[model samples]
Each structure stands twice: as structure tokens, then as C-alpha cells.
Target chain A: MAEDVWILGIRMTKFGKHPDRDLVELAAEASMGALADGGVTMKQMQILAWGSIMSGGMGQQLQKQIGQTGIPVYNVANACATGATALRTVIMAIKAGEADFGLAVGVEKVAGAGLLAGGSRGVDGTTWTPRGPVGAVAPLDGRIGTETMPGVFAQIGLEYGHRYGGTSFELFAKISEKNHAHSTLNPLAAYRKRFTLDQIMNDVMIAYPNTRPMCSANADGAAAAVLVSDTRLRTLSLEQQHRAVKVSASVLTSDPWEEACQVLPDVNTLTRNAATQAYEAAGIGPADLDLVELHDCFATAELVHYDNLKLCESGGAVDFFNSGATWRDGRIPVNVSGGLQSKGHPISATGIANVWEICHHLRGEAGDRQIEGARVGLAHVIGLGSACGVHILEKAAA
Target chain B: MAAARIPLVDYLRLADEPYLVASECEECAARYFNHRVACANCGATAFKEAQVPADGVVRAFTIVSFAAPGIEVPFVSAVVDCHGTSVRANLVNVAPDPEHVRTGMAVRLTTFPIGTDSTGTEAIGFGFEPAAD
Candidate 1:
């Protein structure tokens, strides 16, 4: 027999530009809120898992400031999947019977620096390069090169457009239109301005195929969740009878070497593998999902994700988009919280934010962004270097 | 006139004649390119280097308009399949146009200068070009 684990509390800061706060301040606020929401004191927490990409050594600093009652803190960084990785670590600790209650928190603060502002090493023992339009800066090591994030995704759009026989503007416009409409109802979204199809089509191209509106804005924020074992919830005098969301499964996988003719399982295979394992663990399929929060770092990535997640067959994502299957009223509403496209991506915080949104929807506290009667939700996060994490959650039976 | 410093060993290989290096897993039959000391598939360290073919088709490509210092913009980059390995390299000697490139189009390798290092020495790298009929 297996013991059940439940998410008792969740909290997140509004995702946007926060020049006033650092990663620690941002994370502590969310953590404090999560503790209050769960009605659990800091002394009850047995473990703390902190996720942040850019803030080095900030997790320990935050834990100390919050006074976790001498609880063990584990810091993790997996690019965009940092948040999900932290939550998955907590789930594992609970399942292993090592911890009765755990706190998973993720925070990111994007200052004036751009995405490629950080200096890093590459595979060739050289500095990593940042790719962008004219006047891009060379990496510190001068050996590695740089490319804009949008530029990389633009390649996908170029391939998609060439294969489908449509202009890049047409393909990207559809994706922009979908996310913009979805964001109109999400007050926390960074860009709430709705976009017309014509406006999207005519927007200046950041990359050849990707326009400014089609790309996600860099943001700063934090999200946190409190997880407790079934027995622990009862012990803490927390309302155990209340509805709870159980973590069905969490899976992480890296990219595999692909042949030249084959589409490298980079994003597609990792997502499919994680999704398959999660579904198998939960005993459900894609058709059973009520809602999903995916890494739509770019519109092209979203288009590819539709087919990659097995929501549609290969090359059939456009058809699904055309039919409005991904809309809020569609069979499976995607990115209902405006997704990365509208919500803004704060890197490390993005993964935890996805979980925060799902938890809110499950608790029926998502006000305007709530999907009607959403009982189950899935969150997918992908990081650079082809790392991915997928998690599935289900609301307790009424 | 400054004399070109020649390497004692061949450090640069042509894109059309790109060097073939492979890693054969002792634990599994999985093979990889650019020499992986450890088998990623089977997690085996016992591996041997094998030769790979230089010919392959384009898997995907993009024309970059922006580039860092010492690098040219409006350049074509591609993921090419050579033998069984898919390697990413810059495509040169052809029009840097996205429309001209297509998936499954034949391509070959060539070597060119990337830039100077901190030591101020010319560094060369492999790039690709459209295959001649």
C-alpha cells in the first residue's frame, strides 16, 4: 500500500517587472503566504527546496531569513524547469517517508540585463555565445557565440512555414492571437493588451518569422507550494477533510542523440516521455486532461508542442489551431493563465508558477481564469540544454 | 608580410570533408559523434572512436541576422545529418537566405575561421555548404 501526499497550500507573487526586490525578498513573501495559507508553522516544515536560475546562493539566504526552524534546505537550478524540479523533489521526499511536510519555492528577478546577459561555458570549453540582431556582444570567453532566443525559435517557424506553405506572419499571427485573447482575462499577465490578427501579422519581426508580440517578455516573480503527507496533515490539525490535489506523477528526462533525418527528440521526445510516464502513473491519457500549462517560450514552440504532447499528430498542430481546439472552450484548454506568452517568463520561477496556477484552478480560486470544473491539470517545463520536467495533479474527490 | 601559423596537426577539417569521429558504446550498440567519452545511452565509459561519413541532409536551418563581435551577421546555420549523427554547423558559400534552404536538402562540410582567441591566434571551425550535383 502507498501513502498519499497532498498539496495543502500554494502562493505566488504577481509576475512582472520588480526592480525594487531581489530574488530573496520575492521568494520569502511567497513562502510566507504559502505557510499562512496552509495554516502550518515554519517549525512543522521538515524540508525546504528552493529553485532559482540566476540568483546564486540566494536560496540558502532566503531560508535563513525565513527561519525554517533548522529544516534542511536543498537548492536546485535546472533553467526553466527549476520550479517543477523543486516541487518534484518535495514529492519524492514525501513518498520516501523522509519528510512529513515540505516547502517548494521558486523565485527569479530579471533586472536590466537581457536573457543572454549571463556569462557561461559551452560544450567546447569556450564561452557560450548570445545570438541577436546587429551589435550583439561577444561572450566573455570569446570562444562561444550567442544567438537570440527568438532567433532560435524563428528557425522552427521557418521550417513550419516552409513545410505548411504559408508565410511566417500568418503562422505566428495565429499563435499571438490565441495567447493575447487568453491574457485579456488574466490580470496577472505581464502583457494584458489584446492583439488583433492584423496587428500581430504586421508587428515588427524580432526574428524573420517571430514578431515582438509573439515572444514572451522577461519577468521577475516568485511562486511557492506547501506539500504534506496524509498523516502529517491530520497531525498538524490542518483540515485534512478539505479537498486536496494529489501529485500523480513527476518525470524528468534529457535530450537523446538523434539521427540527421529524424527530428531530434530534443523537446518533443522529452515531453512525450515525461507525459507518457506521468499518464501511466496516473492511469490517464491526453484525452483525460482538463487543462494544461506548457512552455510556450515561443509561438512556434507551442505549435510544435501541440503535436509533441500528442494532442495532435505530427504536422497537425495547425489544423488543431485552426479548429480552435486549444481555446478556453476547447476540449482541453491550454495556457489558460495566459501561458508564458502572456504571463511572462522569469526563468526559474516559471515552472513553479505553472503549478501555482493549476493549484489555484483546482481550488476554484482562479476567479476569471478558471476553467469550468477543472478536476485534473498538467504542467510541462523545459529548460535550456534540452532538459524537461512534467507533472500531473488531480483534485480530491468531492 | 606575416606568415600564416600552421598547426603541427590537422585542427581544421573542411565541411564537405568534415572529419568523421564516433563513439561506440561497449555496454550498448549506441553510437555518437564528436567523440563522447561516455556512452550517454548506456552510461558506459568503455568506448572506441569510429569513423563517420561526411555526407548528410539538412535537418533544419536558420539565417541569423544578428551576431557577436568577430562574427558575421545574416549567416546561415543548419543542423545537418552526417552518417548517423546530427551536428549543428554554420552553412557558408551559399546565399544566406531562409527560402533557399529546405529540410532534407543535401549538404557537405567545409572549414573556416571562427575568430581569434585570447592568444590572438586564428581559430578555425567546420561549416556546411550545398552539395554539388
Candidate 2:
């Protein structure tokens, strides 16, 4: 049987613009902080998995800055799922018995970076490049259908409303209001101010039914984690073992064919598949999750994900939100870290950052936003390249 | 002599009976707007050119009010279900507002001027407009 893996330590830099700091600086802070937290050194780590979207050889560059241990490195980039993908790579290495201790880190510096071009790797600059059919010099986004993230997600939310009645413009805005309200408690969030419903509603509309506040705040940040095999974890001090959180389930899934999924990336089915697999692996259901930190890239995404994650009955997302179950004090509090709305989304960093949030609560380290007596938690991220990752964690026993 | 006109996309036919072309997977009949090296659904390498019906229903839509620099906003972007195949396009010939457009609205393919070049040639793009029910 494969050995179980536990998160020995996790650290996330404050999620906001660090204009002066580049990717390496941000990554070094997170990596060194995680190493210190784990009470380990770079020489002790057997492998390193680094995740980032910016182009460059990050792992080797980081190794030079931190230490030249000559450890094997796996540089990963899976859109927004890069962080989770990197962490999962380390977990797989540990399970394969390649080495007992490993480190995973994700970082990105996207502050002031404008709209995302739907998941396509096409060139987007002042110069027109001929790539797609027809040799079009520019992106077909505003000209044809919108391949922009805001437009894509806006259509998705509206489509969900059209299929499942009872969803309206206000409901989606209310979800954003909830996330913005929660952001006040998270000091590391990029935008911590709470917005009134009117403020969120009347804010400059990016897409119909989705305003500026409803969209995620793009920022620069990094998150890192240290993983240890169960055998190694047992040999550690009692204090370290007690603080370690068990990796109950780690799953990643891509889009499955449905009629219209090609046109609209199937965020729903992929997430459902990941959540189902995670539940089976963890041997627990959504009800068992004390808190959750899901990818709320947009407020519209949060509501649909509530249903996709099976947090509520089929087509019960609106009611679930209405019941206030996703609030900090609700039945199953979700995104108490203000989510991507205010907490900021640094792309690659978001995945490990989410796991970092859950580990804090699991270790009783989450300060004001902590869910009291929190035990089991889940972190979910869906990159529109159509990849979804779900990680479930369990608190260590005293 | 008339000015030359070009279809903005390769799949759009500018012939008398203008219609969109899709690469249909021979195995699962999956259709793709762009050229596909292989079938995403069945991994089949075989495909055939399939003409898409001009008429479609609005399955979903959004009126984008904000956009990247140099791109106009407040346009109606929609996913139209055309004879089982989904096509992404902008909705035209109607008010770009919720009160004017809605899901299930019938629409038909139309063409509009994208821009004109120094050679007096015009580039045309495709869109969907409200069809008389």
C-alpha cells in the first residue's frame, strides 16, 4: 500500500501587489518560510516541485538563491491549478518512495495585469500575430464571441440561471457581497473593505450580471508547503506530529464531453468529478467538511461551485446561499479567507495558498476568521484550461 | 469592379448560400469551430467538413460592458445552439440589453463589416440576429 502523506508545514506571503518584488523574491520568501516552519532545511528535502506561470527556469534559479542541494525539481504550469498540481507532484513522489521529504511552491506576479484571455495561449499584444484560422492579426474576442474570462464566466452564470430557475442578478451580487464582507477579517487580502449590495450591484459592470467587485482581484503572491511521509512524520517530535495535517484526498480532473462543453469550458462536470473522487478517497462527504476554501474567481463561480462540489442538493445552490450556509458563521462556512474576490488571486500561488488557509484552521492558527473546532477542510481550484483540483485535509489529533 | 470582401474566419463561407463549416468527428459526430488535429471526445483522427445551419436558438448570452483596451464594450455575446452544434458569436441587429434579448430567442446568421483596408477591401465577420419567429 502507498504510504500516507502529511503537510509538515505551509506558508503564504500576503496576497497583494509587490511591485518591487519579482517571482523569485516572492518564491524565496514562501519557500524559506515553509522550510523554517517545518523545522527543516533545503539539504534535508529530497525533491522540489515549483509551480508558476511566468516563463523561466524557476526551480534552478530558486535552488541557487535558497541552497544548492542538487535536488530533483519538477517545474509545473497548469494554468491556475499550478499550485495544487505542484503539491500533488510532491505527494506522488513521497508515495512512490522516491524520497520522504519534499517541498512544493507556487508563485505569480500579475498585479495590474489586465483581463485573462479565456485560457488560450494565443498572443495578446499591440502587434497583431497570425495564429488562429483566417490568419487574423488580433484576438477574435470582442470581434466574435468573448474569449475573455469575465465574459466567459458571465455567460456561464447566466446560462446556469437559465437552466436552473431562481437565479437572478442580485443573487450573484449578494454572493460577492458575502465574500467582500468576509474579506474584512482577512488582513492578507488585497481588498479588505466590505461593500454594500448597492456598491457591488452598481459598480462598473464588466459583464451583464457581473460587476467589477464580483470579479477576482488580480495580485502578486506565493505559497509553499513541505510534505513528509507517514514514516518520517512518526519519527518527528510530538509537537511537529501534532501540528501536521493529514492529506486525506488529492484529485485533479479535466473536462468531459458534453454537448456544449467545447464552446464553454465545462467547469461544472470536471469539478463534480474531482469532488466525487475526493470524497471517495477521503471516505467522507461534503457534510463532513467543517470549512472550505474554493476558487471563487468570480462570485458567479462560487454559487455554481457550491452545487458542483455537492455542498447542496442538485440545483439547490441559490437556496444554499440564501440559507447563509457559506458565511463564516454558517453551517459549512466557505471561503472565509475572502476568496479570490478580495483575498486576491495570484494565479499559480492560489492553489497552495488555498491549502495553506485550510492548514491554518486545521492547526488552530487561523486568527479572527478561524472556524472554531474545525477538523476536516477542503480546498478547490478550477483553471479554465478546464482543470479542476480538489484537496481534502484532516486536522491532527492532540 | 467591386471591392474585394473577405470572410473574417476561414470556416465562414462567403458563397451565395453562406453557412459555417465545422470539423465533424466521424466517430462521435463532435463538431469544432477551429481545425482539430484529433477528436477530443473519441480520439478519432477521421473527420469530415460539416455545414452548420444558419438558424439557431440563444442558449446563453451576456452583454459585456467592460473590455480590454481598443475593444468596444456593451456588446451582446451569446452561445447559439445551431442544430445540436454550439457556436460562439456576437448577437447583432438588436438592442444590447436584457429587456431586448433573452434565452430561447430564435436568431439567424448574418454578416457585418469588421473593417476596411487601404486596398479598398472589406473584412466581414459573422454574427447572429433576431429571426422572425
Candidate 3:
């Protein structure tokens, strides 16, 4: 494929519930910041790919709010990985010579929605039962509805505990402790308050083994990225060049049927497949990555990703964490931006937020969270079931 | 009995089968799921349906506590593979105790209900449980 697609700017809103801002308003603020950072007007954008998980409108309303004129605007909704999917679409369009400049924006405003509603129906065309043991829905029945993301992830922790000889308390606590510590440093994080392992272990259980803190908070936020082809980048003034980060590769994949039980179909094997493709496309391995942003909606998801992304071998993620391989000052410095665990998961906004964080790292502008001398970075995101998108970026050479 | 009209065919199919249902190119032997209008492998819409085996080893799994609506708390979700076909589904019928579940253990398909939509119907679905001896 073609190399050297430059990111002229990146921006994100503070991730949390914003009652005053609707989805469109949240997306607009980030879009404005990105446009200003890129020193480009909205009129110059050749294409707009808007990604949102549950924005009521399919992003046409969002585009209008952002003052997007008569450009080809495509709306994408890919659950949690929506942002990365949007970015991949932009990159693919640019590679196909479809556009010189592209914009990818992800936004979510999740509040007031009942958690136990709106699950994906089953193959026999039956709706998944919501949370809580009520009526005939026995606690032992496997047919619980979509409200089970946290419950599903908790099982991951339990399995990890079984394999590593760690207690459920130890495994889940380590993940919470690490991310909570990381979040304390992030001003924009949802749960800035840190928790002790004792607290995590003893906290009220939302699921059997998963305590409240072990889960991600649903919130409202938006993130945006501006991509320009190499041909367009060459025309930028010298001052504008200083802010650019190059896109090394972008990859997306869906899950196979068998992976559903191993991990979420969209995220499990798809993440690994996408990461492999991204690594190959970027001509680098996981070892070359200076930093990373992962979809840690639950503490267990982050631990599993340690193996799925090949940051460690299979069944070795716990040891990797215990060795401090994923810490900010540790080997790879994963989630230096404070992953979904700390930063809050706004669903669609999360994937773009990862990208935004990576761009900030590459531009050397990530402030206290910056990885020193970082040249290469990776961003990964996954939606419900096997849909996933991964992107690799490098600091633009001067 | 009146014939039941499936609420959402694609959604139900996904929930029931839990397999990435795609076509493989006869020319390239490349496999794809999600009913690709055309083969991503060799650009041919004409292809054969391939059901990836649902018996893969556990690559990774997670337990989600703070689930969205319509899902229960403390349910086990995992990624399993049978051959090259990978799927993500709920781990079912095992004891609620965490000690009983293993990553590399064998699993198979079982039916369950996801939820009814605004129509207020009982929609049944499918999930994975530990394979029986």
C-alpha cells in the first residue's frame, strides 16, 4: 500500500458525562480544536468519516453542527471500535486516491440509557435477557443480554486467575491498581481517584468476581483526527510541518465464529489479526512500539490484550504485568494516556481517543504522560463481536 | 401454531450461530464471514458457505461486570477457536464458581435468549457452554 499519510492535527474532549453538551456539540468542540491545530479550514477537507456508537442520528446531525459543507460525509457505527473504523475508512480512501484530505471523528454521549435494554437478538430471533435474576430467567441460564460486557470480562479475570494461580482478587486488583494509578496522572480521566488493591478486592461486586472499580464507566466524549495525503503534506508551510505525525499503517478485521467464547468475537482474534497486519504494514513488531492505547473496558480486557497484541506470549500476561512491562516508564508504556479503564469509555469516542493520544505522543506534546524519545506508537480498538481496527503511527521525520 | 416472524434476521442469525458466516472464494480458497456481497479474497461474489469450526482453543477471555442493558452481571465471555474459525460468546452451564472455568477447556454451542426489542417479545438466542463429555 501507499506510505506517508500525515496527521496534521488531533483533538479530544474531556471524557466524562457532560449533561449540557449533546453529541453534536461534543463532536464540534473536538473538530474545532483539530482544525485549528492543523491550521486548515473545514472547507479544505475532501471527505468526512463520522463514527459514533449511539448518537441517535447517524452523524449527519454531527456534521452539520461542525459546519461541514458539501463534502462526502460517511457515517460509521462499529460499537466500541467505531473511531478506529472511521480512521481506517479515511486511510483506505486516501490510499485509493479518493481524497487528498480526510477527517475522522468519533463521538458518544452515553447517559440516561438503561443498561439492560437494547441487546442484540439471538440467531433464533430471540432477545437476550437483561441483567438481574427475575421471573424465569435463572441465574444459571446462559442467555443473558448485552448488559453482560462487564460480566463477560470478569470471567476473563477468573480464567486468568485459574491459569496463573492468582486469586480473582489478585488478578482484578492488579489491573485496577495499575490503571487507577495511571489515571491519577491524567487530568481528563473519569476516575481520577486511585484505589488500593484491598479496596478493589472488597468493593461491591457488580458481577461475582468483578467489583465496581474493575469496570469502566459509561460517559460522554468525542475525538477527532485530520489526515492528509503525502501530496497534500508537501504543500504545508514549514511552521505547519512541525505538528505532523505520519500514519504508518491502518488495519481492520472481524472475528471468526469460534473466537466468541475465547474473547468477544469483534475484539479477540480480530484484534490480534489487525495488530499483525498493522505490524507488517508498518514494517515493525510490537517490540518497536514505544507506547500503546488499548481497549480496556474492563480490567480483564487489558490483561488479555497483553497476550492478544503479542506484547507477551500466551498465558504470560500476568507475568508481564508483574514485571512492569506495560507501565508508563516500563518496557512499552501502554496506556500512558490512561486507557478506557481510567479515561472512561464513550464507546464510539474511545477508538478515536486512542488515536488522539498516540498522535499527541508522536508530536511530543503529551506533557507528563509523554514517553521520552517515542518515535513509533500503536492504537487498537474493538467493537461488539469480532470487529476490530488497529493503526500504527510514527513521528514525521523532519 | 402461527409461523413466527423473526424480529431481526441478521441480528438473530449472529446471536444464534455465533459464527462469522462468510463465503470463501472457490478460486482463492479464502474464507470470509458477514456475508460479504463479494469475496474479499478473489473479488468473486459466487462462493461457497464455510462454517468455521467452533472448537478453537481459548485465545483470550474477559468477564464484564458493568455490562450494557439486557445482559446479566458476572457472566463469562470468551474467545474460542475451532480450526481457524474464531468466535466470541458467553461461557454457559458451568458452575457460577470462577474456579470451574479454564481458558483452554473445550466448549460448544447452546441456545439462550438475548432480549426483546420495543416490541416486547421473548427473543431466544445462543451461547457457548463447556463441552459435555
DockQ of each: 0.23, 0.56, 0.19
lDDT string, candidate 3, B1-133, tens digits: 5323232222224434454343556776665434556655457777776766655565445544544444465566665665666555567787644477667778876664445444565445556777776
Which regions of candidate 1 are displaced past 4 Å?
Answer: A117-148, A154-169, A201-204, A234-243, A256-265, B1-11, B14-35, B43-52, B67-70, B112-124
What is every candidate's alpha-carbon RMSD to the true fold? 5.1, 2.4, 7.4
Q: Give the chain A TM-score for each candidate.
A: 0.88, 0.95, 0.89
Binned by DockQ into CAPRI classes (incorrect, acceptable, medium, high), candidate 2 is medium
Clashing pairs in 2: none
Tens-digit lDDT track of model 3 for A66-135: 6657888889878787888888888888888989888888988874343422254323323433332121
What fraction of the correct interface contacts does each predicted structure contain? 0.14, 0.55, 0.32
lDDT of 2 by residue, B1-133 (tens): 9778777777788877678988899999998877678898899999999999999999888888877766677789999999899998899999998899888899999987776666667777889999987
lDDT of 1 at A246: 76
After superposition, which runs of candidate 3 have C-alpha atoms over 4 Å from their true positions?
A1-3, A56-58, A112-147, A157-167, A259-266, B1-133
Candidate 2: lDDT over CA atoms?
Answer: 0.89
lDDT of 2 at A299: 83
Between 1 and 2, whose lDDT is larger? 2
TM-score of chain B of 1: 0.71
lDDT of 1 by residue, A1-398 (tens): 45778888888888888988878888999999888888876778899999987876566788777884777788998878888888888888998899989999998877334535223422232332323321112332222212456656666655554455433557667877888889888877877888888888677555545667777778888999889887776675435436467777778877765443122225666777777788888887888888888898878788877776777766777787777888888988888888887788888888878987887788778898789788888889888667788888888666
The deviation in Å at residue B70 for candidate 1 is 5.5
Superposed by TM-score, candidate 2 places the C-alpha of residue A339 at a distance from the truth, in angstroms, of 0.4
Q: For candidate 2, what is the TM-score?
A: 0.95
